[model samples]
Target chain A: MHDEAVAHEFQYASASHQADTAVAGMWLFLATEVVFFGALFLSWIFARHFNQAGFDAGAERSELEIGTINTVILITGSLVYSLGVVLIEKGKTRAFIMCAAAAWLLGLAFMILKFAIEWRHDLDRHMFPGADFGITGDLAGGAKLFWSFYFFGTFVHGVHLAVGLGLVAWVILRVWQGAFSAAYLAPVLVVGLYWTFVDIVWLILYPLIYLIGRAT
Target chain B: MMRLLRGAFSGSLGTLAALFARLSPGKKEGIGWRVSGLLLTWAVMLILVGIQYGVSRLHFAPGLRPVLLVLSVIMAALAAIVFMEIGKGPGINRLFAVASLLWLLILLGLGSMDPFTRVMYYVHPS
Candidate 1:
């Protein structure tokens, strides 16, 4: 590795200082994320409450196996991310890039699974949340509460997943461009933190969405 | 397998603690311990609360919500302790702490509103 002059101009006191700054920045960003996820969760709760039986109807159709698998995948992605930072510090560039790519691919697979398969099931079941949504329970009128929440909550969460993939792509791009090194592994750690936060949100969502049975 | 995971999380957090511990002791005499304490407590509390709802027949939903929210605030405080550069920086610490507390207020206040207590109220309507 060549000793780059311009890069050494603004000298950091130590690697720890740089790491600390990045970590602090990550936490601050996560604070905003907390607000974001918090609002979505609140909305889900309100809608679910408003349409208990309808939600239960939808829940019956949820594929627990898919939910369980996705949960495991995201958790595994988190491990890859945390471990990747350490590998980068060791200067294992190949492994580091592989980990980032794996995380990205896993994330993409999750989205596809949700959109292509899980979402299809909901659509076929007429759980579209808008006009076609219905009340299968004894109570009259479409179980509007359930369908509305299911649609809105998943859509909002889908947006978060999209944002997460965007961040992962940005990180992977830097890896491909050979920007990370022992002294500058901040990007991996920060993005990894963001990834884990996304996983945590799903951790809460999975049980809430799939576990609650119908009230009828 | 689960043991390894437990080890991984604990080990990393401990390593971070050890690193901070080694740094020259500053105004926050025991910030490392405090942060670790807060994190551990918050984690355990969250799990227990989750168990209460998921498995237990308690059905203690409303009363439990506020307590869990308070614990999450504490969790955020612990996170601030670490992120604020506890052993070295204070500016970021105060900022995060204040922000977390503000969040606690807004979420709990609006969240606890009787009319808005949709989740629990619907579960066991009054």
Candidate 2:
């Protein structure tokens, strides 16, 4: 184990204290993020409430199969990253690196499915909310609103995932450089928190975007 | 008599501690126990996802939408508690975690009050 004192910051009383502070800070940031995404969710509720039929029609038009597959990919990525956390806690650096690499690749797959494949399909279907939008009739207004939310929500979410991917890559580099050990795993733990937060956001988004109003 | 009472009390305390030590997932539980426990949580979450997807496909009442939301909340709680170790963290950390959700509830509840309660505005065909 690396000496806790070596990684210890001067401000904290002990290495453990510093680690605790780091985690608490991450939680604080995540709290703000909850409210940030909460605003988006609130807007979605209002839009759907006013335009129920239109929203349902728009939701039905969504690519459910691709959405489900991506959901699985993201969830599996989280699980892999979590296993890496456990491995690192045991000081199994090599095994942890392997898990992280696998998780990172899963994240990449999620992005490709979402952007390269799904977005292309959406564009071809005229799902983009604009002059070229395909949906018409009395429900056009609401369906347009629904697509607006879909594109905006997923795009914002994709940005967050992209950021997470970069963080994971950085973590892998740092871990390879021997910056982390069982005694000093705060960075890894906080990054895991961020990654999982992204996943949780997707969980909340899944029902709102793809599942809700599907039956109708 | 006082000495005998003290000894009995101490003995009971020791017994309670021993029970806790056995029951808790402490260092004695070993790494394998922790690893498997985490994997179990992951498995259950995936199963819940499958259930959510399947239920959405059926022709259920729209009111059942809340059930899906509830399931998602449960999954989020699991991830927060297990993957993030929110409960095992410091009390202040748990407070931070809960506070976000609380604030969101307040935001949603109050934010919707105006739109939900106010008379519907429609432009007259002038």
Candidate 3:
């Protein structure tokens, strides 16, 4: 629990002010991340615009079933984590911990499904953008570009997910130590912001990677 | 040993029950509102996913693909605004959010102009 007397940092006027600043600071970091991912999206736009047939061909090759499942898992994890944050705010510490654990497990499941099953399956089919690439003929170059985007985009997003899992783990430990209360839970809020942003990235990537051109 | 195992098992069940209670909407003011809102967000996102996947399975005009992409952007926006509580945040935070999107637009716009506009030309025998 927060000590009422020394509730905030020396730099802040009040505990609430400090919390607001922390949340704002997290937003600033996410703004930079927006640009970072935006560049990749731009590349994809150019590639898809010029090479529609090949790009669609590559998109059709993606594992739609697994992609849809992962999307469900990730978005569900975001909700579970959000619930944990709300529960903590209401001073339901034990329930909050349970929610956090559930969210973490969901995140772990996503990773396992993504890297172990999906990626392994992709490699088996030689989806990597190299000599052994599965697609061929006149559309091969564009298809290769699409595969490049798929591998790079998912890899970068997976790294972010790994980082999010670490943050969730840290939050779980801190909350378990009784470091947060209704009065002081900025860390939880910041971590929640980051985790949800990760989910948002995946949400956008889902269609680009798996949905677009599948009907072709 | 059996007693210890049983205790742990029951304890796990108790924790799950408590979590369910916290998540269930109730007469409680703040907790109920928050839980219901989050659950609603989850349901909406799930429904959107269903629609998106179903749409992808049927053939559509290439020009219509952007519509599906726009739906995805909406999902991302919904998560940002609701789950992140950006709507309830301070004014400056909203500014930052808007600025990030504006920057992304600038990047896409200017970056694409060259390739999209380039015309292969020949300065021939003149």
- Collision count for each candidate, in order: 3, 0, 0
Considering summed lDDT, which 10 consecutive residues are worst modelled in model 1 chain B?
B76-85
**A118-183, model 2: which lDDT tens digit per residue?**
999999999999998989998888898899999999999999999999999999999999988677
Q: Give DockQ for candidates 1 onward, in order.
A: 0.09, 0.24, 0.41
Report the lDDT tens digits of candidate 1 across residue range A1-216.
123421432465556565657767876877787677677667656555554555555665566556655655565565455545545756767767777787788788788878788889878877665665644445323255555655676677778778888988888788778776765666776777667767666666665555444212
Candidate 1 - CAPRI tier? incorrect
- Taking chain A by itself, what TM-score does each prediction score? 0.84, 0.97, 0.96
DockQ top scorer = 3
User: Model 2 TM-score?
Assistant: 0.89
Candidate 1 C-alpha lDDT tens digits along B1-126: 446435644664565455445532464544334434434543453453344234422334432332333433343333333322234443673475358547945874687464354344336556
Question: Once superposed on the true structure, which residue ranges of model 2 sit more than 4 Å away at CA?
Answer: A1-5, B1-28, B121-126
Error of 2 at B43 (Å): 1.4
Please rank every candidate by lDDT, starting with the best.
Answer: 3, 2, 1
The most accurate candidate by lDDT is 3
Would you list the clashing residue pairs of candidate 1? A56-A214, A135-A142, A135-A143
lDDT of 2 at A54: 90
